[model samples]
Target chain A: MSDGRDVRACLGVCDDAADDPQHRCHPQHVGLRRVGARPGGDRTRGRAGRLLQASGRVVGGVSVSIDQRLVELGIELPTTPAPAGAYVPAVVSGNLVFTAGQLPFVGGVLPATGKVGEGDGLVDPAEAKAFAATAALNALAAIEAELGSLDRVTRVVKVNGFVASDPSFVGQPGVINGASEFLHDVFGEIGVHARAAVGVAVLPLDSPVEVELVVEFE
Target chain B: MSDGRDVRACLGVCDDAADDPQHRCHPQHVGLRRVGARPGGDRTRGRAGRLLQASGRVVGGVSVSIDQRLVELGIELPTTPAPAGAYVPAVVSGNLVFTAGQLPFVGGVLPATGKVGEGDGLVDPAEAKAFAATAALNALAAIEAELGSLDRVTRVVKVNGFVASDPSFVGQPGVINGASEFLHDVFGEIGVHARAAVGVAVLPLDSPVEVELVVEFE
Candidate 1:
């Protein structure tokens, strides 16, 4: 049903396509200005602006456009999930892994939202930890779906933990501890890696916490 | 020529040796904070502190005491050159390449330091660009020295450019353009990839700018 023009335009935006040199040279213009005005000044608006800016600036290369290749292989990018508050979408490096941010999606949609270690009536720390564990499980499932196997993982190098905090909730580390513990239980020594624990005002849909992992493969 | 005690102490810090997880987890507590307070005041201090805290804390994985396997093979991690100004060390991903921050070092020491666009009085943009290109070349050299081949590269994904700036420097993009242009010239389309142009207050030892790359390889 598509015309030649549509195919060419798609190729132009595709990650796997040969990109123009001018386009490849500049892929993102991320700077402090994008971080935006602090404290409840519409975080989604800022995030959208930044994401558009990043996505708008094209970087051309074989792998720089990996997503396009996936499409060529008839794959589709999953929708950006509601990060159970407090984390990043992905991190990149050469010949390595960048993880998409994760969230607790019950029945493919966000169902739980609250602050850990706070008097949030919706979720307790233990329950929140369990939810984080579930979110991590979801993240791994997503990775497996893309890469086809967990066997390629060489190391789970870094974890970024985001906890939807209630200012007084000082146990963000402990809440995310469940994720670390689960990774070790799954991958043993390889899962033991570096991490960062972060506190955020609110996550997408006010989910309690979100976690992402960087998995290295051989 | 070292005393028995010094040798013993050195051996103790080696990976898979007798190491106290707690002690190594607090490098700053042991006064080994290599990057510290710059003239930027609290923000810089906070960033440094966070970086230090996170760097030492090993959440899992048989402890971070596992040194690079290359050491057992008798290979040494080269003294990586510091960024010329504000920037990060590296970004990582899955089964490919992520580069550590790289600066130009001659015989393992910094021989040049300054902004890329002005203030240090470099005349032509080509000269400045060429120098940045050399720094990227040095970065690849470090990667080769560590990983053993450029052929393993699947693709170059992103190059983060950090330029030491003069207030009048609007050519930040142009100066770093040298690195991008040269990388493509060196590796063809595979070398051409995504990039970010960043300006910072200062870099380590005042080098013109620092270049880092993300490469994908088989």
Candidate 2:
């Protein structure tokens, strides 16, 4: 799965799919590529491998074009969240794009607020995890706004997640896993990334979670 | 000051200074390079340029080698603080180095604690500002530990600072400026970078300030 040649070839095909509209690799159209065309017949992961009909990574056979992957996962990216302060949503430096810390703002509103913990009057860790995932989606929205498409991303470099937690809570990593796991689901292998999660006293707008990303792009 | 040629030439000479100890851009030495060598004698800042004995950037003649600059500013970078968890202090990807969030620890101790705000039992804003600077210094120490020498840094890219706030604390930028200004003091023009400042509910170890850095190196 880490083979650079295979990854490059798959990405090259995805790029071609993007460039030529005639190619019907659009989202809502199944895995990135039809597994029927040239199935390598890889049997590494038992019957699951047989289900892979994605892209050029014949090894797993389940690498979909980024757009279609989102549709397949039933995740529609919301509008890129507006910045809350005097800064852009994301900044590009060299080959990397750094996203500003984003709160979980769904439909321009925080779904929940308050510190996260197990006690009463606090947001549940489970709910905060969902918010972390939503924040991650917002980060992708920011990246997509900057790059025009998420397909240009080559690697998800790092994720920094801040969870507003009660003094007795210390499950920051578990909470941030929502963001990390969502990235993995969308980008497949390339979405896997290094991460740091920490508990914070509070976040802007009283949101329970905030996430920022460092991604390498073409 | 933003001239590529001058910045490159200055950095190259700084590299040489690091390579050859006899060249002596050591902290004890006056200025990175004596303005006496080849003063372009630019009249931009008038007599202030008369003090321009540092490196090849004749524009302001004020750019000092990072080491000597710290010395001149009466600042000594403390030992690189140990990361409290299961991660490296800094990671290098391509030309960039991303440092883990750093807390303001001096001599292995948090000088003060508690959320920052304008009330009793809270960390004072001024003290929190210094803590941010100390945290920024720790970030530099971590960068130096990874790069072997700070002389190799070509640019300071992004900084993310987190301040533990007392709910009413709205001076995050002011507190984070301590880190930003310290970076400018050390790296001169290169230290000025894009930044994000946020007030968090709390931080690990109940630290008042935490700073992370993304820097570019040769």
Candidate 3:
């Protein structure tokens, strides 16, 4: 279900569908395209390949302390999100994880930054969408480091997005749509979540957008 | 320690300290200042006086649903924060309160909006610090709604900030100082918290800044 061409084509179709509020793709399709995990897919039971086919490469670059028990569950940590300002990176209280805002940074440079409807300023929409998705990936990486595996994630409860936009921009939802859809694509039904799409006057580093995620532990 | 003039002077000093990178008052202070309550001195706990001070008229033109538990504990709820964009006001989960980005909207219109560190966008150091403090008040209001009382707040936890800024600006820590110091003043040691401050290219409605609070419930 996740051929490269198939994912790209699905992205294209979803972009079009996003423009029409009435057109909502089922949550399963998004799960395949984003995180690459199929709903009800199980790993650690020697079905690792199936889980991999359903998601992207979560190889390395992650550094943080996660629970020892979670590590034993076959969860691979992703890279920690870099701080973009004077604030700390993440905070933990009990079983919940609250991450600071994350930008879509590749090699410490914003490939795209700008309003989605106004054309990417520092980064464009497609790229920003990718960046937002990547930011979500980074968030997962952080979660993995803290909890030991993406498996401990009960659900992606809420996502708050801040998109840098032009004054006249009205497609805030569309821009954040990329991230939202990607989340579902990754976590499947567990990935489905409640969210807020906000158009801000600007974002940190003039990046097109910034994202923050809240996840529950199993 | 609660000398009227001394407390006022200390507030003045902290208010101007926004750009100082040192100490800035936070929510507890804002709450205390509202009631002329200061440490090591007047322990004014009169019911009528407390209500008059905490819930003065109405704010932001939005009513919040204060938790009955908080009410039983004698905590007053602040007004709901006005949405900066096309998003719901706030969300609650279990014993936590997550407030959407709150702006410095007083009556209805923003008293100030623009980039900081550029010819005083919202009030150089003192005013900007006060603005952040005011925003904290709004966040407290949101928290009260979820937990019913400020006392239910086991800890202030974390605050994430986004400041609209001029391209050449770099005064994030200074601006966030206001909120931090204010919270400390209001909740005493419980108000002390972790925070993040980032300079954004812009914010919704061209508002100078946006703030969100993560509070733990008792």
Candidate 2 residue spans exceeding 4 A from truth: A1-96, A106-109, A124-126, A145-148, A167-177, A194-199, B1-94, B97-112, B141-152, B158-174, B181-207
Q: Evaluate all candidate structures by whole-model CA lDDT and list the values in order.
A: 0.46, 0.66, 0.54
Across residues A1-218, which tens digit of lDDT does each residue of candidate 1 receive?
Answer: 11112222232232211111011211111011111111222234343332232332132322223334222223233444544447544444553566777886655676577765546374676666656656666666666554665555556665656767554454444556556545533443344444444445567777887877777766
Q: Against the native chain B, what TM-score does each candidate's chain B reach? A: 0.55, 0.73, 0.64
Candidate 3 residue runs with Cα over 4 Å from true position? A1-32, A35-79, A85-87, A93-95, A107-122, A168-174, A181-186, B1-93, B97-117, B120-126, B141-152, B157-174, B181-212
lDDT of 3 by residue, A1-218 (tens): 22333443343334346534356685423323332122222333422432332232231333222333224323333456444322334445657677666766554556665555544344455555666766665667656655666666766788887776666666666666667766654554455567887766555445677778877776
Using all chains and alpha carbons, the TM-scores for the candidates as numbered come to: 0.36, 0.56, 0.56
Weakest ten-residue segment in model 2 chain B by summed lDDT: B29-38
**Per-residue lDDT for B23-111 in model 1, tens only?**
34222122111111111212232433333223321323322221321222122334444322111123334444555445555445545
Determine the backbone clash count of candidate 3.
Answer: 38
Ranking by TM-score: 2, 3, 1
Q: Provide the lDDT at B216 for model 2.
A: 90
Over 4 Å off, model 1: A1-218, B1-95, B119-127
The most accurate candidate by DockQ is 3
Which sequence of candidate numbers ranks them by DockQ, best first? 3, 2, 1
Model 3 chain A, poorest ten-residue lDDT window?
A31-40
